[model samples]
Target: MKKIIILLLIITKISLAFEDCIDFFKKERYLQAKQCFSQINQTDPLYPYALYYLLRTRVYAEEDYSDLLPEMEKFKNTAVYSYFYLYLASINRFKNPKLALEYWSKIDKEALFKDDIPFYYYLKYQIDKSLKKDPIKEAKKISLYFPYDRFYGYPVVFENINILSEEEKFNVLDRLAAKRMFTKAIYLLPYIKDGQKKYLYSALLYMKNREYQKAEYFISLLKGKYRASAVYSYIFFQRKMSEKKKYFKELLKYNDKKLIWKAANYLMKKSFYLQKYKDFFYYSQFIPEKSRYYSNKLWFLSLYYYIHGKKNKAAEILEKNIRYFSEKPKVYYWLYLSYKDINRTKAYKYLKKAASIKKIDFYVIRAREKLGLPLFEGKPMFLKFYQSKTLDMIAKLKPIDYKAAYIEARYFMKKHGVESIAAVFPELAARKLSDRKYLVRYAYPKPFLKYATDNLTYAIMRRESFFDPYVVSFANAVGLMQIIPPTARWIAQQKKDRNFDIVQLFEPSKNIEYGRWYLKYLDRMFKGNIFYIAGGYNGGDGTVRRTLKRYEIKNIEEFVELLPYRETRYYVKYVYTNYKAYQTIYGRK
Candidate 1:
């Protein structure tokens, strides 16, 4: 009994120590994390994780390369061996190209971690370029297939593609234009042989730079169908229309499927802005059946019909098209509301159907409330280790061995519905498998809560950036709370924190601090209304205020459904949903 008690105490200490080490690593305090990792007992279950962190710590710190080769050699037979060698190769790429190339060739590309995949391709491009190999082919491959956005801006391959034939160059330029890399496309315009493509891109380039006169010069160069294209009409739409009849005639002449789709999408927003529901419904029909926006068009058009006292028409359209939408609970709820005046039986049937669905979306919650159903609960699952060859291997070797095996088995497991063996790795499982438990503990760490001037701050953090301290949005909103630089500066000024720098926003504690302050500020401005606070947080305060003034909002949900910007509308729903979920989970209500 005494021996068992001693064992339990030791295990407790190790678990707590490992947690602290992981926390340090996540916060980017590499040196502290390394020190914490170094203190773990070699016999502990997490000893392998400590070693992995120690190696990563050295790499992150830019320490001497001498220890790297020796350390990598020591772990050459381990599961993460490729990861180690790849790190060494990446750091040595420019400094010692020969040695880097050798290591790169030795490392197994398929064994790389998810974060390292993109970097591997990036290094491949750089190394092949240095070796005078066909770097263009490598770059093209990466640019076409890499799943993530470029961390280092556009790859150097674009510059080298200039040496290819004019037609090939034009194809590449066209791809760049489609991706909205306007500057890059313009830079390669001299290499395009096609006069029309050149003129179009030149006009786009000048328009992007806000040089309207120069843009008009290139626009004048377009003739015939190109003149009636969406491109010319778009420019005219931005400028004053001296002759409305002529403008509408040319704009309505867009027979190109792509242009018609674009014009219809634009008109949806324009008609809404002008409060012309009839015109909005007219343009919505032109949206292609295959377009991603088609379902949105259906929902809004049905909504217009319902608002204009055409309930039968709304029900007809919704019944015909509800299957196209992925948000079934929301669609069913809308169907229920639409049928209330027409068929009482169908209304209750759809209401009960929507309530029974398990999704945690806004409509699911509302449907449950209407039917007196309980809130959705996520029960944690556990699987005990079994007596198998795989388990035997995992028991005798490093946890990373199990991690590598699990990664390789993902497709098999996914297809066969076998449980993820990733949960078998103690360190990795602690981060990924537990869902809400780990998310709350790591993301909404208790230390940060003391800084919250508003209780909803942590909930907002989850919705904003999912507590990823390194996250950055397309709009350049950085860190956990997704605060843009200007907002961070404003918060700093309000607090008289003159020493606060923008880079500090990446710290979880600091981000939560600033975020809470902003939330409190918004609360005061919005007069403690959570819906308005959430809306103002996602869409600007000015936009929310203008929207409120523009419409008679008898129902918040209805108003949200009609929001002009799709993202902002969803943002309000997501933020509030997250807030409610948090309240329900923690018994905070």
Candidate 2:
């Protein structure tokens, strides 16, 4: 009895000391963290973690960690050892290229964390270049894996541009344009041919950068279909009514269905807003029935006729196109609304069709509410059995290394998306866990439940980072809530938090708190409208205000459909759906 008690006490002490070291590390008290980590005995199960963090502490403190390399290597074949090798290689890449190569050779490239693969290729290219070896292979690898990586990918590809194929060069250009790296992309254009493509890219780059005059210079140089498309885009951005109408009229001469659909859609919306029924009808004819925008075109046309006291025409349009949108609940719901007073039997038929689709979305929710049905069907009976079986399988298989699973899961989620979590734990797949409740719980985890329980918070976090607190976006938005550094700093100042560092935004607790505060700030700015609040969170308050002021937003659905920014439109839909899903799953509605 005494022996067991003594062992328990020793384990407890080790756990507490290790946690203190972690706390010190998180607080950036590197010296204290180093000392605490060093005190951990090698016999403890956390010894590997202590050694790893001790090395990390030195690195974070900007101190030489060459001495820790020998100690780190003692845990050969371990995840911590692999990470240390990569870190040392990265830090030594410039200072001691040969030594960096030596460390790099020790890493198993295939076993590397997905995020680390880009850096691994980067270090390989650097080593190849230093040794005067052929680096084209490494450069191609970098370009293929991380084409938009400004720091590593751009440099390698640019340096090796002379040897690259035309296709590879164009790939780099496409990625650069997509990422808005116009300056670097411009330098590559002089070397590549294809005048039409180049002019279009240049015009698009300037246009997207909001330099309308610069875009027009390139647009003037373009001709034929390219000119028509560029002019349409330029007018769309420039918002000159005369130029818009001129280019939109010219666009109809081209046989391109995409451009025609775009022109017609814009004109249709404009005509609807202006109450020009004849013009609206003319433009609506150009919208191809096969285009993706056709359903939206139908919805707007139906809405226009309905509001203009032509209810029968509205129902007729929806019924004519109902086959194309059989799976879309919004169309069904809208059709129901059109027939509610005109034809009660038809209205209930469409309502039942919308509500019985077995999907959870805005329209489905509205349809269910109209029928007084439960928002969520009750949890499936198989979910409990599946959970039990998954636990048993995990215990039996022991497929995942729990010690390293969290870090691996974060990287996996970032690379493959949250739906791919089951890949990290084979037991989940082996048990064939297909319960919607479990899947939703995994994808939209509420790790910061202690900070906030409102569905909005989790919904935002799920959309932003899928609960990966260390994830950083291309815009430099850090952590679970994807708060940019400037915004986080401003939020900190607003709360009078003197010691708040931007680095703290990577911490889940601080990120969630700051994000929640920003949401409340948006709530006040947008009068607690979830659509505007969500749109403001993603597209900024100015964008939300401009959209609300510019459009005749009669309701939430129309506002979402008419949001100027496609990203914001999808963002609002996703976040709102997430909010509704959370409410349904947690019984909060």
The candidate that wins on lDDT is: 2
- TM-score (C-alpha) between model 1 and the true structure: 0.67
Specify the poorest-scoring 10-residue window by lDDT in model 1.
437-446
lDDT of 1 at 150: 48
What lDDT is reached at residue 45 by model 1? 48
The estimated TM-scores of all candidates read: 0.67, 0.77
Give the per-residue lDDT digits (tens) of candidate 1, residues 234-288. 5334544333224444666656666666666766656765577676777787788
Q: What are the runs in model 1 whose C-alpha is more than 4 Å off?
A: 1-70, 74-96, 106-155, 164-181, 201-248, 277-302, 305-328, 331-350, 377-380, 383-463, 466-468
Candidate 1 backbone clash number: 0
Pairs that clash in candidate 1: none
Superpose all Cα atoms of candidate 2 onto the true structure and report the RMSD in Å to 1 decimal.
6.5
**Per-residue lDDT of model 2, residues 245-306, tens digit only:** 77677777767778778877877777765556787788888887787778768888887776
